[model samples]
Target: MQNYTLLPEWAKQEAVILAWPHAGTDWAENLVNAQHTYVALINAVNRANAVVLLLCPQDEIDAATAALASNNQVLIVPSEYNDTWVRDYGFLTVSDNHKNYPISFTFNGWGQKFDATKDNQVNSSLAKLCQQPLIENSIVLEGGALEIDENQHLLSTASCLYNPKRNAYMTGDEYHTLFIECLGAKKVTIFNHGHLEGDDTDGHIDTLVRFTPLKGIVLQGADNRPHDPHFAELFKLQYEVSQALPTHKIYSLPLPLVLDDEGTRLPASYANYLIVNQHIIMPIYGQSEDKNALVIIQSAHPNYTIVPVLCHSLVQQNGSLHCVTMQVPTNTIKPEIIAKAQLGVSIL
Candidate 1:
């Protein structure tokens, strides 16, 4: 009878976990730009008075350390990983009786679109380093695919969680039951519509919708161009969210239409921002709408400081800031690791 409640992203955090980008992964074509984005993201999170646990491949540790100027708020550990998108493979922390427990779910590389054997094993290595026992589950889920509000209301997309490629064996009803039993979700709201073009996760809710600190929902609106393919679906999504959370205020962020060199639409989303401590690290794609998106998010979270990080390079890979990092809730890590993180000591 463990009363485990899924912690929201805005919960007081012990550390922000990130796996560094390297030449081994898809970022090899633009590794420098990707690393630069990571550096900017790390610096932004560090300034928020939150500890950072950075996992880097052994060969990239020196470069990453130098790039970050050896920031004391960061604890760099040498590790092996298939990719840098740790948000999907990292821990989804829960709390019970005021104590935090990190849950490690099975990540199948976003429905096996990518190689994830090593990515799936990252938490096992991290648990040993943090000296924190992981509450392991074989369920297929990703941190980026779900968002929890302060009231234990969980927001997710049916396209990702219910896709046959990801969980063909489980019905939507089964997932609803699992959410209640494991995450203590009082309400599970699944968005039937909403997706970003070029998104590889089928449809991660983080890329389209997010829960704001003001008890509101800030979701990505379709491109203003009516001819855009995402326009209609996003409109319906907005309506669905409004209906689902009638009591909560709804704020819509303009989705900037950004394309890669190949003319492929990159999933540039304002809703993919990360909330750490009292700061919100928002991803901006250097589009004209970037300023407006910032203003809208600020209105949604007036009490917090909004730190904008340029994510042009990140979106080129079809993801953004929140897709690359995972927050470690307070008390989730062992005291020793927290101590070392505070002292800016590399665990390895």
Candidate 2:
């Protein structure tokens, strides 16, 4: 068996990766809006995270560089990708007992729903630029598909992973084997419930719930009011997690605005928050639900300063805060970081 184990996002980080939206992709008409969201995310992460890598396709490389010219806290790595969801196409860092390494897995456009030719080559470029070593694998996976906690338990949803177009041939037990084979996780928790309506990724766990540092979870819950249509399903999901992980704490966050733009409801989820160091970066939609979720999240994490980001435009493409950002674990080290960049490296 491999010695490396996958890590939770709440772990210490070196940097966060953001793939800038350009004029070439679907965000062409709303490129400005996408950038607006990214700016907030980049700025917030820069304060706590050491570096932010902005991936730009060749066509937009010059524009991206100029736009970020004043932001020295970030680095621009010229590359092409079908979309800006780096959390799905970017590197997957796994750590041996000694060090953390980026594991490269094939991303078939979340089961070929979209063109991924450009996105597929992202990690290869990153491996060369950051000089991050790659552990290539054939089992398809995305960074957004799973949410593991500090306890070595991998959490995910069956809707996305077990979809017919993705891995229909594999049994549930066999899929769990890949978690062990690839991530070194101790156990697997696959939820069949809890999903955002507009989420195109087929119930990605990030949009439904997240594992918190307090051995707790922040799940999307329905207020059971008349306006909340998915009350029953969300409530069932809460019970599923509560019963499954009985020893941990649980905080249910109210649903944010069923955010929409141009007649499409975006995946606005408070559960899709990012934690960096002692900071909690949450996406806010300026809805009544936003305030309640923040209070509950803050109560659960009194030690961290909660930073709410206005992500109205960010979700226009059906993904929100956590969907666009990929955290680099602090414990990882590339050969260049030590032998060349001289940033200091130590075996875990």
Candidate 3:
């Protein structure tokens, strides 16, 4: 048996990968505001001494460099991408006997909802840049679609993993076997309940649930209003998680009810927070529940500092903070790769 294991997010990270927003992406409408959020996110990750592996298009290299102000712990790599949602396309790091292996899974633009030809090729460039031989897999898995605990329990939603658009040939048993073979998951829990309005990924687990370092699971709580559309579904989701992970302590984070300019509900979820080293970079909408959510998250992760960044603009695109970044586990990135990235070399 291969001694492989998918590292949890709380694991020490060598860097966090972020794709810079530009006129080419959906952020073209609000590029300035989105760039501001990216700048803040990069700086926040840097505070924990985690390097930021920033990917920018060749045309935006100078602009991205200027936006970052000081590139102290930031490494910029020029590349082409279809979108800024790196969490779905970036490499997923697995470990065996302390050795890091970066796996590249196929990304089909969220069930072919959008064009992802360029996004699918990102890991090839990243593999050469990081100097790590990529473990290529044909599984249609997204980083944000699954969460793993320290015990190797994999948590995800059935809506995504079982969707016919992504993987039509695989049965549940086949997927289970592949999870064990590729991701080293000791157990897999697929929740049928849980979803957010305006979510484009078809119920990605990151928008609904998460595994924390304290052996706790944080779920996105629905609004208190009984008539709210998500109340019943989220309530069932909480029950499902409790029954599934009976030993874990559960914490509820309030869901912020945010709407776009057209009065469309946006998926503003606190469950989409990113864990980087000793920090939990949380997404906060300018809502009344922001403070309460922070308190709850801090209590669950008492050792880590909670860094909140305004994600009002991010959710407008149907994702939040965690959707835009992917963490590179420690020992995976080489020093030479960092040096080359800092010089803003074109990886593509």
Candidate 4:
């Protein structure tokens, strides 16, 4: 169990981590397009903070280095990985009263669906890179499956964490106890209702609800339609859960009509937007609804500079802006501490 202190959205972050796309797994049919979009995302992130792009092999590192014209903005680390969803496998950082530490919740490839050997390695690698305490939790958790507020309360879904496929061994309360221990979260409230039919991780809550400062949630809402089985249950869940959690506000953002090509509906939703220090990187579908989604997100986050990232390629691969990258806070500790802390120390 790792005790986590939830950092605010406006916290000063150090850098963002991205796993360079592999051809077979994430890119398969659209390798070139994914790479281009990844580069663009790296470029956008570099404007505000440093970026670490995990290269699969030495050859890939060379190629990525060549592709990224501004090498200084990005660091190509040789790390093998199966998918580009680094947000799930990457380290989750928390700053204690004295020093900053990153907690690596053992990633089992979203419950062992894919190869996560390299993804797990990323945890210690990132810890080594940041020179901070890294607590490895025994329980299975993904960064994508959890959201926290300044008060250390967590927002999550029963669909993913409580799903039998992910953790059939543990009961709901048992799983939540691990969350409390790892995140130091006051409570782990379950969003029990909605299910995104297209979501693969049994409906990740990041695609349904997001916290905006001390205000409330910017949630995805859809009308009940006979053609869509998930709508009714989803709406009921949102309303009931919002009522249960009154302290936290909930704002419904309309869902963009499902995007499909060749009869296959992709995981396209506006709720998967990423929040950086100075900017809110949102996904756009290039549809008329894209404008409305942007306007809604902008209204919710008036303080941030909203950056619309064309995520058609990313969505096709079943992820978006927030899924592709993970942020690491900058360390300004003394040089002597950096050298001493690298060996090891009990963060608690």
Per-model TM-score versus the true fold? 0.97, 0.92, 0.96, 0.88
Listed per candidate, the RMSD to the true structure in angstroms reads: 1.2, 3.7, 1.8, 5.1
lDDT of 3: 0.87
| Model 4 vs truth, CA RMSD | 5.1
Which is superior by TM-score, 2 or 4?
Answer: 2
lDDT of each: 0.87, 0.79, 0.87, 0.70
- Evaluate model 1: give its lDDT: 0.87
lDDT of 4 by residue, 1-348 (tens): 334575654567656778777555668788887888877787677665544445455557666666665444555566667677988888777766646777777778776677778777766655656656677776677887887777776878877887665677988788677767656777778777776766666778778888888567888776523356556866886786678678767767666555657767676778888777778888887866788888888888888888888888888867778888787666622334333323222110
Candidate 2 on 47-102: residue-level lDDT in tens?
A: 77556777876677667656653644666677878888888988888887657788
Could you tell me which 10 consecutive residues in candidate 3 have the lowest summed lDDT? 339-348
Residue 121 miss distance in model 2 (angstroms)? 0.8
lDDT of 4: 0.70
Q: Hey, what RMSD does candidate 1 come out at?
A: 1.2
Q: In model 2, which runs have C-alpha deviations exceeding 4 angstroms? A: 69-71, 130-132, 224-227, 331-348
Backbone collisions counted per model: 0, 1, 0, 4
